[model samples]
Target chain A: MEILNRTKKEGDRTLLDDLAQKELSRRKFLRFSGMAGASALVISGVGLTGCVRDDDGSGTDGVNLGSGDIGILNYAYALEQLEAAFYTQVMATPYSGMNALEGEYLKDIRDHEIAHREFFKAALGTSAIQGLDVDFSSINFSSRDSVLATAKAFEDLGVAAYNGAGKLLVSADYLTLAGKIVSVEARHAALIRDLISNGSFADLASLAPLGANTANALDGALNPPQVLAIASTYVRNRIIANNLPTS
Target chain B: MNVHNLLHEIENVDPEVYDRLDSRRKVMKRFSFIGKTLALAAVPSALGSMFNKAYGQTNDDVKDVLLFAYLLENLEAEFYKGVVGTFAAIGVPAGPAQGALTVIRDHEVAHVAFLKTVLNSLGVTPPVYTAASFDFTGGNGSRMGPFAAAASNYGVMLAVAQTFEDTGVRAYKGQAPRLINNNDVLTAALQIHAVEARHASHIRQMRRNLASGSLVPAGVTLQPWITLAQSGIDTGNAGANAAIQMSYAGEEVVSQATVPITNIGGAVISANEASEAFDEPLTKAQVTAIVDPFVV
Candidate 1:
């Protein structure tokens, strides 16, 4: 499939080249180190007093969730952290026998993920989750099949997360944005899944066909608890428990 | 409990909430009421009163809804860019299928920007953050290779895409009811939703053809052909051991052995019909739970 040709022709190196540049920058590394140091200091200051409870002490610490919106935002922030950590690790030590093309693509994925993580960080500001230590003990980053399989799972789950969250939005503007982003996530999910299981792209009927499936099932949507299970390993703070709105 | 008993309970205990909802429902019934009142009386005052009434009820709902949409789009944006990035790292050339994916990605970007704009207009603070990274495979604490390893294996990608797209379609459908009051917003969401359906069908078709060599006749025009059968066959989780249960528009339709898409004249199964019936709306809790882990 002449992807290299197409990528070159299209000048779509924004994601790839951008990350590659950061890898070369001493300044970027220093900045990241500083941020890590700051995070440690902040974590220590709030470590004891941050353990807020929901009358049951089951919820995550350091989160002062006042409303349903805050709860939902926290949920999203957690997912972003998982994705960010995964990509960061992927870039740090790419799998063995990785081809140049594969290395390039993985690097791009890392860059994009970093961007997503940072975007959420900026948007959530004080509301965002502190960098929780991620445990990648489950993934085999050295194996080709293992990495792809994990990627597929993450992509599919990510798409479902966005799809599931759309209805909770009341604002038209937010709805529009959700619509736009979900479509992209859908594409990502589709592509990654296809990469994992060739020819599985058109196999929804076997998984959840129409008449048997609602519109919600098509995009791999998932609820908060479900999303939490998938993202749990990557996040240290527990999600503040809140009752989801029932139909 | 049976639906009959459920209905009885709703009528007996929760009459007020139901009645309040029913009263608002009537506003749609009498379309000319607002127009007539404005024309016959003090137009400005009547309009002002209408706005006032709507404003009070909408502010809270709008804030929550907007936040929900914003979060959804942000997640999607991060996911898609992840896809593009992941694939590029691998040697997989952006193929014909990749083009279709690109269109989908563009649409998602547009959705995110549009939602941000909408929230801005509403004077709501948008939650913008970094693009969340993704694990393309189910990383099991082992070293990994290129993100596009599935490119070498057709079964994996098809399964992943089918699941993801099916979820997207269902999620949008599930959310449609909440948006019915705003015609423009509803139309916009559905349009994008439908487009997502098309993407789902294309992926499903590719998988089906790859698996069993079942070809979708070229140039089929039926929406149901693409949506109902092909997309269904590819994305539905109806097996006895399926992790998640599914339905279409509240109907429990079973998955068929094959995509049965007959043309308008019954000559051959058309593509459009297969594409149109790919709708899958999910329950709200199901969606929230699925995305919760990612919510940092």
Candidate 2:
């Protein structure tokens, strides 16, 4: 009990002093805590004492998206990587009967996804996770219906992932960035839905598979666990996201 | 000495004591734990300070964000109401186009109600406004502006609707940072924000379809996503009606977080693609400047 109290006090003082003197960003502080290890674990109150298994190059246990803002960023990066890869494949092998406009738009989507993926990777810098290997075996790229259906799924999932992850962000700047990206994702979702069926965009009732609520007319928001569960199907590697901040 | 009695006493001094705490049950559980840990005399002061640390301060930033969201929703709800009312006059066919507009109008109304409920829960009496409070013609209620024909022409109505929906998405994105402290509110705002984006995309699709003379066009110059700040709506002769351009102002950003997005990872991303990759946020002042002309 004495050791616990002392550890808690020291952790609190270190955090408060750093906040007062340096005005450190949450991401910086989280990185600092990651280095501090056990002491920082107490500060987070998760009660775990040991190094969090983040990108340790151990493939057996999967990639553990650490905690706090960085974890969320990595989570987002993983999704973007998946999207970029999928769209790249879509463009490389256009679906049958794809007109000039559809071909142009799909290529545009591929470029946008690449841009988003690169943006997250650069923003995360050294903390960014490795490029995820996706499994697109289920998607029939030659079939328009199959490709459009998959695109709609990924777009909706991306929107929900960002929406669910928004509240978990501690930095206002990061929150705003996520906001900027999520709406674009929503726009993509709408466009894809329209491509499948005209006037079906924003029709939440039909998107029950994605957890959309028709009553509220609000888009669905899936937590990290829920998002990862669906993303795992296409994402070959296991993404351990247990440490993402819930509050 | 009883936890309930202590709460009752605190309630007399501060009527919103319960609201400040998580809940009565949680308070009782926490106080019981504290009762066993500390001496009985230390309970009141300890509880007081605990409450102070927990929920003593009200966040005016969050309130301001909510209020702004409510106002935007009201503006959109009114605009949609007008569109729905004059669908036939505006040449909006009685099929998918009209149906899409109606769905968007309902969503705006729902967002307004949701925000109003949230404000009321926070003890704020949200200002009540209706179609009377807005000018859909962008003439500040004069009803004689560039978009005056918006009520009678399908093309004009779709343009104005597209502008409003796109602006709504940006406006909501701008305020998301303010609501970060309140997780539930942030999530709710995001849900609405995405819906606005969906609305914007559909409106853009509608405009493109109308132009191509088909319910679903094979190819559209105006993609669902904003490309290089192009409004896809007319700016009048020689861009005389440039006030509407403010809605797309600063949307051509090709960089994010100081990272040049156009050329990354050895791949050349076009400036237009980079801009369309991520939607930019508008400040409150910027959004107000764009919307003020239409607001009375």
Candidate 3:
């Protein structure tokens, strides 16, 4: 129900509104029932009906990440594509005053991002979404500050995305695979942070925006919609992740 | 299969079951209007799943994973405690390096406490381990292993710290699959996992800075991320320390999910980049082997 309202607020009124309408009708049916003990049964029946309804025909007109495990995979593939492209551009036009070591490490990062993108692409095979169109006009590639800031943003976002999506995966193998990739992203985030300002790699005070590293010292985790909203800044494609598993 | 009977059975086992199910009363209020329209045959399975959702999460598998995590956090907390306590003796000046070590020590301590609270909430007693319980030298309390100088040398201390942090990342990853049924715990564990990776990266940066005599080095290949199974630390005598090397084992893998990462889509992704792009998991057994040398 919270997600229903969120999607509605985002102006995605097609499939979500239909589902909400169905739920309203179901509630009306329940209200008209005379038997007192059968409300629980009706509620349970509504749940089953909702699960069945989620099987098909709810995708948006955009790049719809399908349902279930494949949807989760495509979601990851899309993020990797964005990151890979960003790094490829960063390497293609190195920022001014970037020292020799910075250039070398940036190239290494570029290659790593490329490797991650290709791995996801090959792993996804026919199910992979098409290459995304990025709008990097806001980023000043010639300026080291701007490029590093954006890199930090993407790395942190990637870590949060994977952390939030791990539980959505039904297969343990996929969860482990995601786990394997996310740590690398975190490592990248730390390096980028340090390159910007020393010893701020895991600084709890500065991590509030990303939403973790509090008193508990845990990293951030962002759900699909929250992540897509942030990622949509640079990605031109309207990534429709409405069908990703909620639980 | 009556809903009331199920509640009664649960109440018999957990006297405060309704309190645990905070919304049970709201759900019960809806019972008055459902009978005429709903089929009787559809009641039990849905209620069963709902109850399972409410209660079936903290099973033995989740407990095992949590317990393993607890042990690892205890180890890390103890190691950092040693480093922070001996920073002055170890040549760590009272500056950014010392400050960073203190921050890491605090985080590890918080992790230990957090895991303890979670385990206790699940009705399990977390085992206690303190600084006395660990030997940072990998000497099993004898303090004579290859890293014996770790307590006195800043570089050795940073190397040992990097190894533990890297191992922590891998250990958390390996146990994630066992926690799949418990989403909150899984997400929490991943949060901790990423923090450990950050710690590793910072330690690597410290080591690189130390080696190059520059806060930001020039023409140095030592990266925050591990490159192709390289320990990036001096393990002594041509890197003969098997205990330290074991932490990096299987990290050179260029294949994921049976797909070779090199030359993918005709991109010239070197094996080094392929391996660096992803960190591999270490099973509980492998992690135990890596940590046993330091545990008494």
Candidate 4:
């Protein structure tokens, strides 16, 4: 993960800057309003039901993530679609020096991801969103470094997405299903991390600090906006998550 | 006094009593209907009570659930600490493998400290069990559990490591439903949950890399991703095998919520693939049963 520097096309800050900019601006206005003795009118800018966003770009440009458990399922399904597509490409174009063992493991991961993708598609039934349009042109699949690096990014992102989204589900079954799937993502993340660098399976940057001490923080728990920002770069289809939970 | 007899006498005394009683009964009926509706509508809090007996809380509360999580972190922390403490004796040579154990140990320690902070913030006293409290040997001071021999062997220690990490992953998942309404806590638990999964995966990988020896069980795929019962931990002995199975009883669950996942889209997914794709959660009883031996 790129370190936050408040300006860059790096992964961490892109989406957050857009979303947080709005939130911060709202706070500023309210603070100014409070000074003028209009304090009683302080309204919450974003809510847990979902954040308000204007990124639909006329509906077809991006996917509108719906409300409640269905929206959450759509979110998971979108991720699986991206993963399945990416791995399909990885296998289709093996990286240089990729061994038979790596191929076999990558194929297994690819299949599991496909199964998850189909599971959500079926579970969502008609409620499922359209297949996401993935843009892998930026990826250099022929290079081991780029392929594994991308794999690590996707796996880590998938794990964090599930971690943060698990709570937004109103249905216990959805939460359980998310739990069932997320750990597998975690396993893949570790394997990919090892492939990239052996020892740092759960790297420090992925740990979202609950407090100042690193011990109190959890590894790889990016909220929706932060995850989507990194994910949306590869995803050609716009992903709208207005209905997803905020809190 | 019998209310039935009193009502009967009152009915005989006044002819208009019957009409009055009927009106009162109708009002009571309305109240009962509304009461039933409200009760049915309050499922989340009721879901909260299923954990009450475990934590000694009245009605719905997450404190007991958090305490159970505290116990799990404690269990994992102590297991790793014991292995790190007995590194050379356990045949863990000074290398990356040993360093991996230290990483596992440190993560568990962090988890413990993190959970304790949450518990303290909630105004509930966290459990005071320390690394010294648990006897990971599972031998009540005798140090003779089937896994005891493995504790000293690096390869077998990896097996035990897999067991603890796998159990931790599922235990967090099992307890997640009770904390579903508490998103902050749920998010934190899940954050720890995946880290445990990463640990489990690497530990399995460590075992897979072992030289083909007595320690490596024959005829099993030792791939890092769990594939139901193809797990390399099967030692063929009944007691140890039972322990392994206990940690994995629900891992092969093809059922999601209530229905079969294979039934979705009428997809003909193999049971192995279906089960391997999704990790299952262990119930409180199931998890406790698996971890009880190491508890002391």
Candidate 5:
């Protein structure tokens, strides 16, 4: 599990600098796991494990999450695909009683999600995985309650997924890109939350803050596994993230 | 720091010999030096004048990022606290705007607490900027700006909230790359980023709910998401358009990877839809420009 992954910018040194400074033989490895989603554990005196791809050599044919940063990008891309498909359906058959303004918000978000999905596709080019197959059978698109509820869930899940994955990216550009998209997802999340229960947008309890939070000051942050677990219910394909970096 | 000059000596060495040298320290030192030089040369010179002394901190890069966030969050928390704390004094009744503002205020307070905790844990003291440090009315010392009615009026108040929250979202996105090396910081900033986005969205939603007569004239039309129309954002026709421009200046970006999305994706989205779909980043300079007026 990821321990002390929460950096304590000790004076002038960062955790990454410390890790890089340490001698080659005694490497400190960080694995993100615990506290349901946002905790990271630092492990020492061991070989990095559980990072080999589960795919059969060729990564394209199945749910293979390449490796390293590409794997994380693909993970985000996959979620965007799910969101885009979901919104496309929502617009194609809007639930009853969606006003022009409400309908406009949904349409803007749908375009944004589609842009997001395709941006990753262009950015990744060949490294991108096959288009994901979705399962929306459980969601009743005709009902506002069902559509809004499902939309809220997806938006919340997208925000958390990025929160957890931000630590895994090695490239600064990609990290910035992920940050750019995640906030919009949050905006969508807030709108959907408001659409459901007027003031519930930021009312949910957040465990992200350190110390006691009397105001429940933090927000949602889901690890890849936790997100995939929920997303799996909506995605029909068998997703495998074995090659993702844990340290 | 020239790579060619640095590699001259190693060019003659066999691959096997270079591998056995175990010179990780030397290599990292050169790499870091190159990174520093690149960072300096990369930032556009035209944007340099906008930098501020308020955020000038010399600590771990991540520490600086956290403190910057603390400044913005403080500004937001105080803005909300003033109005939400004195709902009646401001001539506003308890309604949806009041309810929405309360929720946003709480989130801002939470964000401030979170940033301070992270700064403390980083072994750095958080800078304190009291609410008196701000001048929301745009009137320093002796006068109040046109938006002084912001607190007294729900419509004006929502306009101010929209600018602050949108800037907050962009500010977080801008600093994320600097904190990327530290996963904990990156993840935390992103979490806050999304919350700010939610704030921006709800503020827009609230504004949209206002009666046409009570609406904030932001020049151009407004939506919950960003779009590529700056005609009204900077036209000064709306409430303090000049002040609000820094927060939303170039938000109307319609291109990604130097190519239009609608051209290739077959989505058939309009030009407005393209920019509305994505939020752009803003540097500390742009943020301080929009925020400093409120911050004394």
Candidate 6:
């Protein structure tokens, strides 16, 4: 099949376009967007630009997550999808006698996750993956114990994913921004854990095991493969091999 | 709208195109010599400037730091395990403090296990052992070992434990950035690091409650932000150089020191010396020098 000879349009718009195009790589991309860049993902494909076509009973067609920054955007997109799904489920069927405070807290979590998901969608633009169909078969959302347990798991896992990936970011600015987000994730983990067990929150994970800890083992924590596996259930779109750093 | 369509779209696309695009981007990103030099020059200072930034050691030069982190996690896990076991065995006195300490100990074990898994997945063999010598319950370096019974000086021991826990929080924060590319590892480590910070805060609060007055015990340094000044005395004289006296949140908080987690206890600490409550990373030379005595 012949590749389309897409013509480059030139004008004052082209100057902005050229600069925007230059900001497609991981480090350079964040340099251009700062914290806001998370919302400006550019999609690459044949026909679909950034529009999320409201298809009849079907997701929009897939877009190419171009190399580097595009790949990172998709990675984030996948995570946001997972988080948004989990939180949405949590809000849908809260545990028995779940207080007004708990209700508000869970709602806040759902909102944060939606924001993160939407940010990736906007940032990836035409390149972003369409909405994923997540499987929640394993979770008994009706039970408070089950929901809280899952939330704890996700909150902890999200924090860990961020921690492991922060060093992988080539951009200092992006790294800084990720740090802020990870800390928030960690706070979420702590709060959720505390809600379940109260004073037992800090100790339940680290101190009971052994050694003079002498190192931080708290906050949210997870490595990549672990996180990917946990998140895999929600992301239906296959991640294209984009030559982003994995190790 | 649905999973099947998303998969079908993915299937229709050529994976090779993604590969080609990715490689092209990487080739473009590869350094102009000027860019390479500038990045290298900026790295050390940028990483060093903040605790969180310090973990952003992503380049090839950071293998040592990564290895050090692995070793540190191992050492910490072992320490907490020993404490929990000892407390359980005695079946002596149990209270809220002991209960909290026990939970923290369990978390440490999980952390150690988690980090080990990360290293294993990475195909990196972590340092097998650390010198298991610390005077946590005060007898000498080797006196109590990791699981020695809580002594009459439980307060002092708790203070030291709290200090070490706080230091861990800072050290992990310092190491976060370097793992950004490895989303899996970064995520796991961040989870544990946040837990450590909470542990530190709890311990610090306990110490404050115990003493009632603003005075902390000798050889104990609360995080820099928590002052001993209310008790009518300056606890330390490191001046600007103090480990716990750095500015955080626009205030001179307790300096969250970022020493290599492993080396801080086994090598740099003298049995009698106050555990230097500051972020002092031993240079490779210093680490080698201190570890030489214990290494076979």
Higher-TM-score candidate of 1 and 3 = 3
Q: Provide the lowest-lDDT 10-residue window in model 5 chain A.
A: A25-34
**What order do you get sorting by lDDT, best first?**
3, 2, 4, 5, 6, 1
Per-residue lDDT for B147-173 in model 3, tens only? 787878777777788889999999999
List runs of model 4 lying over 4 Å from the truth: A1-61, A206-213, B1-60, B212-214, B255-269
Q: Candidate 2 vs candidate 6: which has greater lDDT?
A: 2
**Each prediction's DockQ against the real complex:** 0.01, 0.38, 0.38, 0.25, 0.29, 0.11
The parts of candidate 5 lying over 4 Å away from their true place are A1-61, A206-216, B1-59, B140-143, B212-221, B229-239
State how far residue B189 of model 2 sits from its true place (Å): 0.4
lDDT of 4: 0.70
Give one digit per residue, the lDDT tens place, for model 5 in A1-247. Answer: 0111222235666433432332121121112101212211221222122122323433543476654566788899999999999999999998999998679789888888998888877766555677877899999999999999899889888888887888777655567678778878888888888888876776556323211133535567777887898899888767767556564
lDDT of 6: 0.47
Error of 2 at A56 (Å): 12
Every candidate's lDDT: 0.45, 0.76, 0.76, 0.70, 0.68, 0.47
TM-score of each: 0.41, 0.80, 0.78, 0.77, 0.76, 0.47
Look at candidate 2 and tell me the lDDT of residue A116. Answer: 89
Q: Which DockQ-derived CAPRI band holds candidate 3? A: acceptable
**Taking the tens digit of each residue's C-alpha lDDT, what string does model 6 give over B1-296?**
23234223432432222222222222223312223435434434422233122223333323554576565555556656565566645332378667777777776766766666666666676666643643343334555432133333454445445545644554555565555445545555655666665565466545555654323645654431122221112233332112222212111212211212112213222211111112222233433332222223
Those runs of model 6 whose alpha carbons end farther than 4 Å from true positions after fitting are A1-60, A63-66, A84-93, A99-141, A163-168, A190-247, B1-100, B106-170, B178-296
Chain A of model 6 scored by TM-score? 0.67
Clashing pairs in 5: A1-A41, A2-A33, A2-A40, A2-A41, A3-A40, A3-A41, B133-B296, B137-B145, B228-B252
lDDT of 5 at B291: 76
Task: Tell me the tens digit of each residue's lDDT in model 4 across A122-200.
Answer: 6655556787778898899999989998898899889889988886765566788899999999899898888777776
